[model samples]
Target: MRSPTPPDEPRFVLAARHMVETGQWLLPHRGSELYAEKPPTFMWIQAGTYKLLGSWNLSFLLPSLLAALLTLWLTWDMARRLWNPRVARYAVLALFVTLQFGLMAKRAQIDMVLVGMTTLALWGLVRHLLLGPSWGALALAAFAAGVGTVTKGVGFLPLLMLVPWVIWRWRHPQAAGPGRSWKWWLLLPAFLAGTAVWLAPLGIALLQNPDPALQSYAKELLFKQTGTRYANAWHHHQPFWYYLQVMFTLWVPGSLLFPWLVPAWWRRCRRADPRYLLLLGWALLVLVFFSASPGKREVYILPMLPALAVAAAPLLPGLLRRTGVRWVLMLYALLLSLATLVVGYGAVHGDGWAQRNAVKRAIDPWVLPQVGWWLIGFAVATLLVIAVLRLRRAGLAVVLTTVLLWCMYGLGAMPALDPYSSASRVMDQVRERIGPDAELGMVAWREQNLLQTWPQATDFGFKRPVAGQWEDAARWVAQAPERRWLFVLDKVMSPCADRSQVIDIGSANRNNWQLLPGTALQADCVARTHGVVDDADAALQDDGD
Candidate 1:
């Protein structure tokens, strides 16, 4: 709870909270505006957790953790089925220690859950296509893919696994195939059934209510967020080789083995090993599929990790004994420890680099130095473990070092960084300056601002333009000038707002905020009323009902 919620994390949790509060689960809202950027399957799980536990702090992140564990379990079981128990263990360990996969599992992000569903889908396909022609497994896999699609819009990526499966099955005619061509058609209904969990409810709700805004929300969610996003992404544009960089860095020690694994995989694939042909082939397809897209993110290809692990699992026993691989593991751990120590030294001494970082991150002067000491101590401990264990046990040392690093950061640094990153400290200042009785209105706010002060604060609108929000916010303050205040981003404060009358609320989440009293509104200054919508009034009306 103390750790900062990434910008998207708060947006998702807030939408889920709204779902629970309004008893309207079909459509999710982000501060009165429809949050149609994503389908609501993931939020349904989050909101379900909130309803069951009645604790946002505990419930919001549980889904990601569970999904991560599910991914590991599927990886382990699939490897065991394909090879042996030893390979299974290696595959799970390889995935668990992966920098990106482990990090996602620890957060409240949708990607991890989507990865879990996709991995499940892949696992079922492996069982049905590679191992046998089990209609039940194929159906289940299709359903999982459908569920995954609604979860993140790319869930159907697993269905692409069939492309490689068909080729491999054709090449090796004696192996299990998709089985009896007609049986494949039955899987469509299963996929629809999974999608219906969300779409079906949504269809019924729209029929019953039929609001134009809701209809627009449905269109944007179904079409733009999926097809348009893939066809022409507006942001996060990168070159084709972006994911290649991601694999090399973010995949870490496991990725370090790629040089050797590549040739070994080629040899096995050439020899027509079904396990390698299916797993490796599907993994390659995933990589190519994502790389072909214009929009790229490190997490977008996360589902491919399980396939990579399983493909590499059989060779791990031999790969681990290689002196070159062991040395790489040992050196990587040592360099990581040294880097932490050096950073800690700089932070503790209050060097220019450290101070600049602290300033940008809005970290407290005292907090950085305190976090520094912990990092220094942890790094020292890591060094001792590395020295004692040495190269022969390099794998163990690296795993231990990685685990310790996460523990130190999660247990020590996250809480210390939370106040600034989560905007709680700024919100605290707002509360202290105005006292509990004052009404707070938000303008040009981010998710954390509203999430931190929800029900206590009224947001103009998340999707509305800044000018429109400002106009609404100004009007709102005019009604109760004495008791009402506007908490606004520094960049968005109107030109007419009297600076002398505003209280600087300090920085949080890399943005400046100020507590603006209604008296700060200049007498001659007119609110930018163009393109304004009275969403604040509509949201208030909904709340009243």
Candidate 2:
């Protein structure tokens, strides 16, 4: 509903402050731009937050957090209107409590904004179409559509979801809508216009700062990153069953009933209510949209979370009726307690706490899972939430408030986690080993900006991180002890134990190590770089420079 509060810390904030301090455009970067890098909308939000808080990082996260809360608020209203009050309650809970959406909503990424904006538009559109396009409603709908489009490219797609209803509103406006004018004609055009308006600035900014890297980023985020190059290789490409798997992991507790509920939903919406079809179709269309795209990740399905959560409402009541609400509440309470234990243990028992090495890097979020603390916290929170629902007959508002509180808490904690477990930790230990003025060269792998830590390489500025030749990279590593210190991401740099006695630091993690998702594994690949070279002049990749 409103801009998020600005973060109090400034130096810790990344791109937006870079924009302010350097007055440089956001486009310039460390590697190939073929992926997608423009904070486009996110940067702007952060910029505003920076202005307000005089700090950048937390401020950057604020807008998305706010957007998520609003989305929860709207989801409750929409669920109540489209289906039942119970559905609204679950919808908000699902969006807020589910780890996946909760994590993303509080991050620096653009997807959270997209989710919130799109949900906002969907709410307004549904309200207008079903309740007769009231002018006041139309204005709200149009404004949200504009913000959504401005926030992300995917924002435009939701407008398509309105096509069926647009037809209903347009053709039979006099008989169909409350405003009852030809005004429905303006709705679709207004949506498109907003897309154009929002995108125009980003399009220009990118064009103005057209560097080679941006082209590479576009290729990746736009093309290569979408699909695996090896085609059938599961490493890069997933099975068609990917989304099915996503539901189990990302949806968490709700996934238990999700599959069975879908068919029931379809039957219920079969003229029993067309809106059920709308919600189902909304999720289905997003699946097809992503499936058809070259890029695929579990998080992509998040946009549909709100709708799916709301749809689960009918089943919750049944669960309450069949098992007794207390049982349902008890199970959640157990889950919360366990989660707290796991999180708490990780916080105290994990690797880097005593040294104040909480954040080894500026960007990594791999905090010890502090699983026990989370479990305990969840126990307390869940009990409170359950009490409100059971004792007070509390509206969905109670569920929503509980969820938003936790999501925001997790978001804030993530940055603290990143430093201890990522390259930042490794960098801190190894930077002291090499002599000053040593030509720091990368090894078989390079992370240009991925390893960007505070006191990192701003002096040299951003360099293209990927290596084109293994021999050259090895050479870079081998020439390293020539009085220069270096950081690389591969163990290949440490191949010869006898040739050079190198050490490992910061454990295993990757650039942006925290972003990599999976269970608490021992970490074979995401992070961990060796500190020495196999040959004094060996090369992992050769640039011939």
Candidate 3:
């Protein structure tokens, strides 16, 4: 419970919390606005988990953890069927040790669950299209694609497996497939059925309600979030080659072997190995699909990792025996160990690097030293493991080092960082300063502020313009000066806020938050809310009139 939800996790958690409290599972909300960025499938799972466990902190990340395990298991079984038991074991290990996969697994995000669904779909497709003409497997694959669609707009990515399957079949007429049959049409409906699990209910509610806000929400969710957002994203714009960079860095040790694996994959493909053809082909298509989009994030390409790992599994054993590959792996481990030790040592000694980062990440002074020691100790142990294993077992040492570092960061560092990152510390202080009986209102607030202090604080609105939110909040606080208080983000605080009357509650999430009382309001507060003309402009216009 010590670690708070990070970044987008709080947005999901707040929506799920609203679902549990209001019994509105069909629609999700973040603060006072409708959360239309993604579909409700992930939130539904999170809400269900909350109900089952009844502990928000423990249950929040459970779905992601379970989905990650499911993805690994499916990858293992698929590799075994296509290759051998040895390849299967290596496949799971490769995926589990990959940097991005493990990081996404521990967070309360939709990507991991989406990856699970997509992986299942791919496995089913491989089973039917490559191994058998089984109708059931085809239908299951279609259904999974549909479910994945509702989870995230790009969840249907696995269905792109058909492109490679078709090409492979064209090359060799004897390839396994569902064959010519009228039952092939059933695949479409099966996929629709999976989507209907969530969309059907949503369509029904939209038809029954006809409220304009609900109608607008449906339009935004179905069209804007999926189509417009993909075609012309308004944020996180990056160059087309961005995901290639992600592959080299975030893919880590697995990617470190790409230099050797690529040639081996080409030779297999040239020899017309259908397994490599389908797996590598699908992985490439996934990369191309996301790379075509202007807006990119590291997690957007995560679905490709499983297919890449499965294809590389057969080659990993032989590659690990190579001296050059072993050296590269060992060098990576050593560098990571040294980097952690340096950061830790600086933090413990109150060096400029540590102090600068503490301000940048909003880390508490005391917490930094404690976490620094943990990092230093972990680095020492990791260095010793590398030395003992030497080049002979560099692969094993890298895997062990990666796993141990994640564990240490999760157990040792996260708790210390949680209070500030999650806004728990800020909310706790607000409660303490205002006392239990005082009503609290929030202006220009984030999802974290409302989430950490739910049912007890009132927010103007999450997406409201700052000036409007300030006007509404100041009006609210003006009504009851003694018993009411306003929590404001420093960036949006009106110039009219009396500095002497506002209490700086310190910084969290890189933003300074302040607790403001009604006494802080100046006479000219109405004219000076952000993005509006100031008092001088208003007076000039009034005098001219």
Candidate 4:
């Protein structure tokens, strides 16, 4: 569907194709379809990047690097304003080590962009509320929020956060002042114009194709995926504390540091800025919004984490000022460091963490990073302890915590990037095995077109296969006896190890989806098993393959 398939970013690949082909953002292609492609904003920028840089290989990494750097800078500034430089440093520290945040940075999803927008919103709101609304701050805040609307739906989040705080300020003249002249009002037009300008292209494209799949994915990702979160799915369900539990397990470093370093006033901090209240409201409103949806995934709540993490950072010094509880914080960091080692080692060394015999499954790929910097993370923890040692009083502890914050992020969290790039390796392997004239098949997953990026990708023995399932694969194989077949599956979906005759050229583990033992490819945890199952007689279920 496009040139330069961003092996890790199939969505961006499709979008880039549309951008280069039509010189526009809006396209009538619905993703998650049978050969369906939707035009999105990623390609518009990615295409521009390719032109300026003359390389598509940097696609995923470049944007991620930018997101990270900006996040660090913005977070530092944000923490400084919320607390002392001490708390700000520690707050930024905790944010850096968030694993989910790192993962989001590398994907082609608009969510990372949300991170940037959210940060800018915080900065602008802080300026508007703390220092009084100068035109610059209001305009910046407006621009950021407006962009968020175009990028991810449920635009009411920021409103939930900022509006109430503004009202609070309006009601309390002693605590707040009416911001500068009508200049803040100018932001509304800028917000509308900026958002429309970027999204207008995609809108135009949709009007042209009018494909149902496009409408469906758009509706689901924008409204259902973003708007609603069902407590129960057919197979996967969780308790009300589901998001809370997920965060505890996944957002390791932050969980350890948040309770000890943050202050208490942040609970109703809207008195300071209509914007701070707006940020909190933005995050929580989305939380309640998801609770009402029928379809839910852990990622549905991703946007909320950044705000909470940033907000929590400002409290570290306040918590430390309370006395003996600071030791509890150190203990938590120690426990976290150990947990990271266990999970990291399990993923890198375990014999396919989920193995139940012939119909085996993989849990490791879903678990670990390839090369962890345990030593570095621990060193950062040590810094936190040292910082605590230097603290003679609450105020001193606050100062120490702030410096250690960013130190922790750099050491503890930044190394686990690049796990998604594993797919690029699978694309290479599949291309090497498949040859000219082989047709590809689409089965279970969403990243099918990811394979098409490689120059040799088109020469295939399979039908340009991507994310196909057992049933769909069996049907494709049955229709044409001559073309070879390869099916890709995540551990839960298809346990290839359970079969007696299947040949595994790569690892069976689907978690982290790396190549077989000894090799270094992270794509598709692919396996190729050929046999003489009569094409006509082969079943489409588990028993068939």
lDDT per model, in order?
0.84, 0.52, 0.84, 0.49
What clash pairs does model 1 have? none
Off by over 4 Å in 2: 1-14, 26-28, 31-39, 80-91, 135-150, 163-175, 178-189, 202-236, 292-295, 311-319, 324-329, 332-418, 430-452, 455-484, 490-505, 508-545
Clashing residue pairs, candidate 3? Answer: none
Tens digits of per-residue lDDT, candidate 4, 432-510, equal 5545555544333234333343332211122223323343454444565355444333332233323442324332213
Cα lDDT tens digits for candidate 1, 90-181: 89988988899888987888899999999999899989877767889889999999999889999998898888777876777776555557
lDDT of 3 by residue, 49-125 (tens): 88899988887888899999999999999999999999999999999889999999988889999999999999988
1-545 per-residue lDDT for model 2 (tens digits): 11121121121234455555566544423322211433345665776787788854357668777878877888899888876776777667666666687767655566777788778777776777665455556656666666665565456556666655554446445554455468766776666666555355546756887776555655644343223321322233565667878888766656655555766786776653546655666677877766664445676677788877766665666654544443443465445554554555555465434223435333233434443345345556655665666533433433543464465366444444544433344555555454344444433333322334444442222223232222333343344334433344444433332223344444433332111001211122212333333342333222110
How high is the lDDT of residue 536 in model 4?
17
Query: What local lDDT score does residue 260 receive in model 1, on the 0 to 100 scale?
Result: 96
The model with the greater TM-score, 3 or 4, is 3
Best by lDDT: 3
- TM-score of each candidate structure, all chains considered together: 0.95, 0.66, 0.95, 0.64
Q: What ranges in model 4 sit over 4 Å off?
A: 1-9, 14-25, 28-39, 81-87, 106-108, 179-187, 203-239, 257-263, 266-286, 292-295, 300-314, 321-325, 340-429, 432-545
Better of 1 and 2 by lDDT: 1
Worst 10 residues of 1 by lDDT: 536-545
